[model samples]
Target chain A: MKFKNNTVTLDATDLKILEALQKDARQTYTAIGKSLGMAHSTVYDRIKRMERQGIIKKYTTVIDAEKAGAKIITAIMTVFTDPKESENVAKKLCLAPQILEVYTSLSEELLIIAKVIAENQEGLHEFIACSVAPLPGVLRIRTSMITKKFKETQFSIADNSKVNIYKRNP
Target chain B: MNEKMASRILRTLSREKAFYFFTSIGNYTGESAASLRTFVDKIREMNLKSLEFHFYRGDFEKWIAEVLEDKELAEQIGTFRNSSPIGESLKNELYRILVRRYSKLKSMLY
Candidate 1:
């Protein structure tokens, strides 16, 4: 949609574009522009604006985490650190390249989750044992192998009716 | 909706006789935190009361902690850490309320 000063405003079209891009970030801007019935430059400008607004995060190549020799392991490591050590422990975990994401729990239980992609299972084990386990204040670590991937995807606006049990508005 | 009714709703949805819907939360083919928020917003707009999710993208515990300020929505969605997907229960009373408020699904349900 058109906006003031040639700046674009987000309308249903923009939302549709966002939804479509989120589903497949690799889609060309030209393709998106064609589908949206807008000029390629207009679409590019709108996307740039959205990125500046932190709405459209960076586009990523969906590499097969497994084929990349990196496994997306989910670990619920219970961090038993003092309240003061929380920040340090979190920082340590965050700094590890293997640890993609980390977050804390409301309760005393500090949840440590990561996607440990190593050269092999032994390498992954060594990283966890020497680097991760040796870290102070880590009370217990529980690891669950991703036996089968049922489904996985980033946030997108699309057919959520099947996803959400609740009935949604059109 | 209480747990039993929620379970019924899930069972009904899973039957997939007339409609088939599927969603999951993982780094691969499931919903993300932002997508979940959007879905919740849309469902709430339709005034849906009952919903269920199998959260496995990242750490549920951390996700829950981040949104403690939104206790109402958190309670509605129900978060579990290190728990199996099969154990989550449905809130059926909420479903009844949603059913009454969002009649649009009536046509879709059949």
Candidate 2:
């Protein structure tokens, strides 16, 4: 059914396609069809439509940094800005390898978060020392190491009250 | 394995505590033991109280150096760096373990 804010209507099959892609974007249309009991072309078309609608984004592999022998370090940085310098500072922070995500708070706090995997303690130290600490506009940084993983999931398409498009198409 | 070896490990870690255990684990075998011990030391030193471990790709040093060293890989690295977060629930588990250890020590002192 259509979203309340937007008039776009998506069916059960569309939901299934979105769910599958969310879990593993690299999943082939043939594979998705087998899971959903649909033809391969149908799945392909739905995915294309989803992309055109701006619902589904790009696909890539998720790696395990610890297994890859990269030391993972995280830091939540706070920055004080003249507001105009915010974009330039964010651009610089975005380029650092250690930084994973940057969030600009409505309270005007620039939250810069990062993760880094290094070969050894020395490597990790150098990465932080040279790469991250040098970024402009960073006023403070609270660094921590990730010792475990909890929840990771793709988008869920279950918000719709009812899905009845399959019958109409059949 | 004998109970002696197991007891030996527990005792060494218990006696040494923070810095001692980290030093001892360098020569320790077993992936779980080595990594766990090192992680424990970090927790004690940083006073994090909680932590979580997750697997992610890309090297921090390699990515930064690649940006400076090679431009194409830099773009690919940029995309990878944009998404990755280890949440609070996992961190709390590690915190519980550390707090339990600290409490046990406090009991021993009094």
Candidate 3:
């Protein structure tokens, strides 16, 4: 019942709507409403409100990377950099197209972590040596290669109708 | 896979056998594809509204399965249809799978 300011609080109906969308975002509003025995207009309004509140972000689909010819080696890299140059190193990592994600972490060590993907081992090596190692204040780099991914999922909209969420408090 | 099998999968079809894009039972979008390559392009540039209509109607799967006779592609589009998407995302996903299949079949020709 309680809510944080500007946060979108989802009711049971909202949760069910999110669940239906998670299954298939293109589910006709009428179909979803019919399944829930709610009016399609109501469903539409809820979805619109959710959109305005930013609870339901953009709709999307996941690609099978390998199937789509994006077969590559993914490495979670830990780069140690001088504290003064840490911010600069992270910025540089973000500009590299091969680096999908970059983060600055103080966990265990002051480090910059990046998710890097390369078409092959040679490309990966080239990136680390030419791109990463050449940066100023660069320290040692350790990479853990991802072998096989079992599962990847987006946000879980599940059995939590009873879970309390704060509504947008204007 | 033998060359003959690849040829069969990649062969061009006659006008009667080409896959046509339709918004409804009678209304055609004036776009038809005789090969996987053309099919991939048609899917890429076709009208989104018409594409969405045909998508939910299972027209794409039926044509791919029965006419193109490619069980793999038909099944791929079928599974995608079952887990449906709409709008631009739908177009992008459909194009992605179509291109992937087209590329694989193309590589087999060599």
Candidate 4:
């Protein structure tokens, strides 16, 4: 664990710890220490340090929606909005429970991209026709349904290797 | 238990028939045990979430009974599940049950 002002560089041990937590977030420090053959207090300190540095982000429980009886269809909706009202429309989209993610594109296009979920095809149709189409943006909408998700995982130790976080001053 | 039945119960299972621990649907802890020994080792190491999840779902007993072909151990786990012990207790007690029966079964092999 090597971190300075605004520079957080995790060593191999830290990455291994992160991997263990990613696999099972609820694992206690003692259990993690036993698994990795490290001290529990040391593990605790590392996790706390990562949390303070905003590297660890947050811990959350991942629910299986389909297994929980909520097998909703996911769609990536690209709503082209009036440049002035794009922010407004994006904020409004955040209010709906069906919207899983909402992001106002910062690129040239006045677009509000959102990851939306619906009960079924009919539900999605109703959502687009009733809720989205009537928005004040007053522009066309393009939706790309996500029929199959090949990979959907938060960037972890495995995915962060390509990042230059490990690179430091010469 | 009889010697023949004990042998069947104590016999090693294939990798395909191994039990996997899942805290929730699609949430795999990456902990799996192919045999009774490995199952005990996993039970000891498995996170509390997975322990509670499988205990409540009766998955432990189902695997033990069906895959391992240890009806007696399965019945023990089944009875234990019926008791509805909490997370830590479930792990400790379940481990005890499995270890006890496993030792007895091993002894019967000779």
Candidate 5:
């Protein structure tokens, strides 16, 4: 099977390798080769090719926030500003350490959902008031504390299934 | 989808200067705990600058019984719930034991 993304075409073996690494990046090339019934060198070569193609950006470690002693807060912020100012405001929000995830909503309103972490409620408030709220074009910021996390996982190749490959006529 | 959610949570945690732990064990059951347990165990190994535990008033024991469905585990956690709203020591001890248990179980399977 050939998985094509724009101009890049990845074979079945490549997809399998990506899936394996997505599960555990620390898995040795030998271990991955054994599982996939390929040689260690083959696994190495495939990974190298994928990296060069920019499919695999970087390896990262995942940490648990609650166990580490920080409070998790999720906020849905709606920025009431000029259409031209939206991009600037989003860029500014990205620079703050406390602002975790920020993405624009599909609706007309410039809505952004951000995940923030702080030592406590007071620290969270301070971050929003002093740092985030003051950014140009940021009109209002509403935050809600994340009381519990039911499920969480790192990025995996499985998500690629949702991508639409068919092109539509303009 | 699950991995994305976990990644977002991890990214949020990584940027913090202080360490904090939060888990809603009651929302998960057997297999779902795998990723959560792995993440918790990994962070525990890191030498963080500061460590704290955050929780709702009585969520600790509630999670054990309702989510894990383990009466014994809930009883063990209940002993720690006797204190205040945010019991740092209790949370730390409970997490340590849980992480150890999960790690041991995982090793046995492999």
Candidate 6:
């Protein structure tokens, strides 16, 4: 039904639709409707409502950077900056094309975790030297090269407990 | 196959303890999918220790460049990049390569 903190009310059918779309975003509305035993129009309406409510964010394609001729590198940097400068540093890091994911750790020190990509070892060195090392308030940078990957996936609607409306209804 | 060949194949498989199979749901029913499933099954039957298999989510070019470490093959696969559900063609190419490698390994053991 309704989320505790928000006004968005979603039912069983909505959850099913969300799961189906998560599995394959390219599926036609008609195809999704057929599987869910609902009309295509109903499927479209629900998706639109969810989008408006911000439950459904932007649809995107996830690329395997390592397979795309880029080496995956992760770095944990501890920034020694004034509290006001932290937000500015984050914004600057987000603007770099090589940076993929960025997050601030909860540790006492201002720890920033970032995932970056480069074509090779030399390219990686260049990125750290030119982009990351030069960023203001970046005190120390520790980097690890990802040699192999085991499992990577996008957010799964099937795994979300909030989307288990079918269980509650049934 | 001779015992020597069989032993060599076993040795190679033993040394290569892990495999990463990059694929997408787009080619779920293709021959490549079948081949990969079979390859995994074979590996499971061997009951080797420290072996791992990763089914990565992506197209063939990505797999070729990342897993196979073949720049030339990645370029060739890139030609089909614009194709919708690029996984189908990628699976086909990957199947061809895996089939050859697997067959050689199979012949030695059998």
- Please give the interface root mean square deviation for model 3, in Å: 25.7
Q: Is the docking of candidate 4 incorrect, acceptable, medium or high quality?
A: incorrect
Q: Which residue runs does candidate 3 get wrong by more than 4 Å?
A: A1-3, A159-170, B1-110
Each model's RMSD to truth, in Å?
24.0, 20.2, 23.6, 26.2, 21.9, 21.9
Interface DockQ per candidate: 0.01, 0.02, 0.01, 0.01, 0.01, 0.01
In candidate 6, position A21 carries an lDDT of 93
Candidate 3 global TM-score = 0.52
Per-residue lDDT of A92 in model 2:
76
Q: Give Cα distance to truth, residue B80, candidate 4, Å.
A: 68
- Over the stretch A1-170, how does candidate 3's per-residue lDDT look in tens digits? 12469555567688788889988899999999999999999899999988877788799878888799877988888888888999998998899999998998897768988989998865775577557765666665777778888876665676333353323223
Give the per-residue lDDT digits (tens) of candidate 4, residues B1-61.
6999887766776644666665653233445677888899899888898799778877788
DockQ of 2: 0.02
User: Which 10 successive residues of model 2 chain B have the least lDDT summed?
Assistant: B20-29
Of candidates 4 and 2, the better by TM-score = 4
lDDT of 1 at A33: 89
Cα lDDT tens digits, model 5, B23-98, are 2211111111223354455444422211222233344344445443434545655665554424445446757766
**lDDT tens string, model 6, A50-99?**
99888899888978655886545543333344455567777888998878
In terms of TM-score, which candidate is stronger, 2 or 6?
Answer: 6
Per-residue CA lDDT of model 1 for B1-110, tens digit only, reads 34443333323211112111113111111112232223333333321111233233222222333432323334433433233333213233333333442243233344
Q: Which regions of candidate 1 are displaced past 4 Å?
A: A1-10, A67-78, A159-170, B1-110
Cα lDDT tens digits, model 3, B1-110, are 56666678777887556665645332334467787778888988998987997788777787777767778887898889877699999999999998898788778888
Model 1, CA-based lDDT: 0.48
Place model 5 in a CAPRI quality band: incorrect
- Model 6 TM-score relative to the real fold: 0.52
Model 2 lDDT tens row, A1-170: 35657745677678777767766778799999999899999998878887787777666678876698765444333444436666776777678665666666546454544444455555554554444444444344444544566864544554332463233221
